[model samples]
Target: MKSSTMLKAATAVLALAAPAAAQDVTLRIQTHYNPEQTSGKLATEFVEDVEAMSGGAIDIEMFYASSVVATVETFDAAANGILDCDMTGGAYQTGKNPAFQFVGDIMGGYDTPYQQLSWLYYGGGKEQAQDLYNQFGMELIGWWVYGQESLTSTTPVAGPDDLKEWKFRSPPGMETEIFANLGASPIVMDFTEVFTAMETGIIEGTDYSGLANNQSIGLFDLAQHATYPGFHSMPSDHLACNKMVWDGLSDQHKRIIETAMEKLALRSALFFEKANAEAAAELAEKGVTLHNWSAEDRATFRKAAQAAWDDWATRSPEAAALVESHKSYLTQLGLISQSE
Candidate 1:
C-alpha cells in the first residue's frame, strides 16, 4: 500500500514538471538594423528580455540588415512564413496600400515621438494598424518612434522655399509629393545608393534617417549641411509577425512579446533623443553645418504638408479613414487646429 501511495505522488510531481520541461520555441526575426546601431542593440536587448521573461522557453533568432529579406519584402516574407517576425517599419508596405503611408509616415503630422506613441497606444492608432496588417495576413505586435529624421544636403536647406530647384533623395509616396510641392526634384532610390549618388553629384541631399544613424553611416562627411531637431519625418519602426504564428502563440508567450516590445518602444525613443543630440554636437565639431528651421518655417512646411495629406486621403477609403483618425487624435491633443 505504501508503494502504491509513492507511485501516485511521483506521478503528480511529473505532471507538475511537464510544463517546465516543454520544448523551447525559437522565433526567427529580421530587422533592417545592423548589430552596432542603437535600434539593433535595443532589439538584442528585447530578445534577451523575452528569453528571461519566458524562463528560457522562448528564444529569438535575429537576422540584421535585411540579410534574410530586403526591407520592402519583410512584410510579405513574414506573412508567407519565410520569416516568423519582421522588425522593419510599416512604411515599406506602402506599395500594398496608400493607407500604409498614413500609418507609416504621416509626413508633418507629429511633432514628437511621444505624441505618436501615445496615439498608437491610447488613441485608435493600434486598432487601425491591426486592421491594416490583418488585411495583409500579418500581425502588428508593436512599434517604436525613435526620433525625427534629418535631411543631409550639400547646400543649405532652411525651409520649403529653400528646397526649390534642389535635387534630393526621398522615399516613395507622399514624401515625394511633399518635396515636389516645395519645387525640389525628388529622386526615389534605395537607401543604399544615397552615399554614392551624393558623392557623384547625382543628388544634392537625402532625407534618410535620424541624426545619429546618419552620423554613424558617415552621411555628414559627404553632405556638410544637415538639419537638426528635424521637423519632417519621424518613422515608427514596427515589430510584426505572421498572423498564424502570432495566433498560435501560448497566452504567456504572447504577453511576453507584447510587454517586451512596449518596454523597447519607450527605451529606444529616449535613447535616440539623447543620441541625436550628441550627434548634432559631434557634427558641429566636425565642421558640418546644421540647420534648424524657425517656427515660422515649420508652420509653412506644416501647412503645405496638410494639403498633401488631404490629397492622400482622397486616394482610397482606407487612407481617408486613417487620416481622419490621425486628425482627430491630433486635434484632441491640441497639436492641430480643429478647423484645419
Candidate 2:
C-alpha cells in the first residue's frame, strides 16, 4: 500500500512539471499600433512565427497600441526592463537619445527602404546604431520601414510657403525638424491622438503612413485633403530588445529571432509599398485629392531636408558621418548632386 501511494504521488508531481519541464520562455513585445493596423498585423505574424518555430518553448505576448506602455515612452520601457522588446519608430525616442534621429534622417534621400537597411545592417552603421542604444541599455535588433508618410491637412499645401505658421502634428525627432524647416510648427503628439487633435482644431495638419494608417486613425475623416512628397519620414520602425533579456535568450533562440526579423524586414517593406499603392488608389476614388509635388516644390523640399540634416549632424560627430555617408551613396547613384 505504501509503495503504491508513493508511485501515485510521483506521477502527480510529474504531471505538475510537464508544461514547464518541456521548455518555458515568455517575451513581451510592445508597440504603438492597434491590433487592426498593418504594423500590428505584421507584429502578430512575427510573434506567431517565432512561437511556431520554437515549438512552444517560447511565447511572445504582444502589447499593441500602447496598451502596456505609451508610445512616447516605449523606448524607455524597453530599455529599463519594463518590456522585453519593442517595435517602434527610431525617431519617437529623440528626447531619450538624439543619435537615434540619424536613422530617420539618413533615409530622407534614399531611393529604397532596402538600401537603407543594407547600410544599417551591413554598411558599418550597425556599430554606431548599437552604440547609440547601448547608452540606453538596449540592443538594436534591426530596422523595418513603416512606409512613406504623406501630408494630410484640412487646408491645401502646394509648397513650402503654404506650411508657414501651420500647426502640424508629428512624431518626434527628425520629423519635427522636417516640418520645422519647412516653416510649419511641428507639434509633438502621440500618433493615436492625431485624429482628435485635427477634429478639435488643435492641429491644422499632420503626416502619417500611406492609406491604411490614415484611414485607421481617422485622419482622412477630419482632414479631407491629402498630399504626397513624404519628405519627413523615409520612415522605418526600429526593432529593439532589452540588453538583459537579449542576453538571457538562448543562442538558438537569438539566431531564430534574428533570422525571422530579417525575413520580416523584407516582407514589411514590400507590404508597405503594396499597401500604400492600394490605399492611395482607394482614397483617390473616394474623392481625396492627391497633391503631387512639382519639380520646383521637390527641389525646395530637398533643400529643406539638407538643411535639417546639417542641423542634426552638427549635434554629434557620429550623426555627421552617417549623414555624409548617405549623401556620398546618393551622389554616386546620381540620385542627388554633390553640389547640394
The candidate maximizing lDDT is 1
Residue 103 displacement (Å), model 1: 2.1
- Predicted candidate 1 versus true structure: per-residue lDDT over 183-260, tens digit per residue: 999999988899899999999999889999888888877888988889989999899899999888888899899999
**lDDT agreement of model 2 with the native:** 0.76
Q: Please give the RMSD to the true structure for each candidate, in Å.
A: 2.6, 6.5
Clashing pairs in 1: none
Model 1, residue 302: what's the lDDT? 80
- Which residue pairs in model 2 clash with each other? none
Global lDDT scores for all candidate models: 0.89, 0.76
Across 292-327, the per-residue lDDT of candidate 2 in tens digits comes to 777677677777888888887788766787777767
Q: Tell how far residue 158 is off in model 2, in angstroms.
A: 2.9
